[model samples]
Target: MAIDLRDPDESYVSFWRERHMCTLTTIRPDGTPHVVAVGVTFDPEGGPKGIARVITNKHSRKVANVLAAGPEGARVAVCQVDAGRWATLEGRAVIRTEPEAVADAVARYADRYGRTPTPNPDRVVIEITLTRAMGRA
Candidate 1:
């Protein structure tokens, strides 16, 4: 019931643009999935080969989940849904603690979510290399 975004129609793009929030899902060590509602930004050129980034802190459960799964683990997916459209981005995440990566994530966060991120080593950026994305118009 999902259509891949490689060929998204106008309605699908419109739906995506209209929504400001989406749920991000990650895998726990027990092989269960965890979902969290988050403010998201659309990367006109992100995901898979484009390097999708999500801003989060080390204290967040999602961060813990991804770190436990390891960088190459295939146990992550990010989903965004509105009334008439939905998209699921499948991928693996790399935990980022480096300052440069954090800076990039902070810039993205402030630009999209309008929140400033104070420098903290405990904060992390989950960079997801999307394998595929499915959306329905």
Candidate 2:
């Protein structure tokens, strides 16, 4: 069944937000998909439409892949799964180092993971503006 992504409820948002780990996939310039285990931060507002934040070392392969993909970066897909449940979110990765963006990312990380992300000059924040969601049981 196909469902409209615009209608994600708070429950759905909270479900994903509470998940401890998620996989983030990005496309390399050559078209190979690189997926990595990552800690994720769901937007405080919560919902299908809110953006998700992820932090990474600026020199990491994921960041390298994003940079190699150019300013628009590659399409990003994030997934959270448990024994009998799963949720995936898809969106374009927005790479930036702006102060506001940095602060937002830091805040999300601290709130969700309870660990402050150390600032790495090489760190780049990826904001996944969710465009879709799907679940399986």
Candidate 3:
């Protein structure tokens, strides 16, 4: 369903803010989905709409999938579930390698997951400019 990031449902926002393992789904070059467990952070105040970030190594397959999509970016979704509640953030994802971007992603991840991510020279961030949300949350 459609979602207004500027002022989303409190339940939805609350669920996303909680610490829960999430899954990131990216389309591979063969048009098949490549899903993997990941830690995701959501910032409703990030941009014009909002943004969800996933910090990962540049060599990760998920990163490769996004890169294969090229300039237009890859359509992606970040989802989490617990008990009977769930929520998903869907958007076009881009791989950001700038030091500043990676640092920011780590900070956000720490805030959500309660621990700083391990330092990695090859770190990169997958940024999703959220466009839709759905689930029972």
- Candidate-wise lDDT, in order: 0.70, 0.75, 0.92
The best candidate by lDDT is 3
TM-score, every prediction: 0.76, 0.85, 0.95
Could you give the C-alpha RMSD of every candidate to the true structure, in order shown? 2.8, 2.5, 1.1
Task: Quote the lDDT for 89 in model 3.
Answer: 88
Top candidate (TM-score): 3
Cα lDDT over the full model 1? 0.70
Quick one: ranking by lDDT, best first?
3, 2, 1
17-126, model 3: which lDDT tens digit per residue?
89999999999999999999999999888887799999999999999999999988999999999999988889999999999999999999999999997799999999
Off by over 4 Å in 3: none
The TM-score between candidate 3 and the true structure equals: 0.95
lDDT of 2 at 85: 72
Model 1 lDDT tens row, 74-127:
467777766666777667787878899788777876776666867676777887
Candidate 2: residue 72 Cα off by (Å)? 2.7
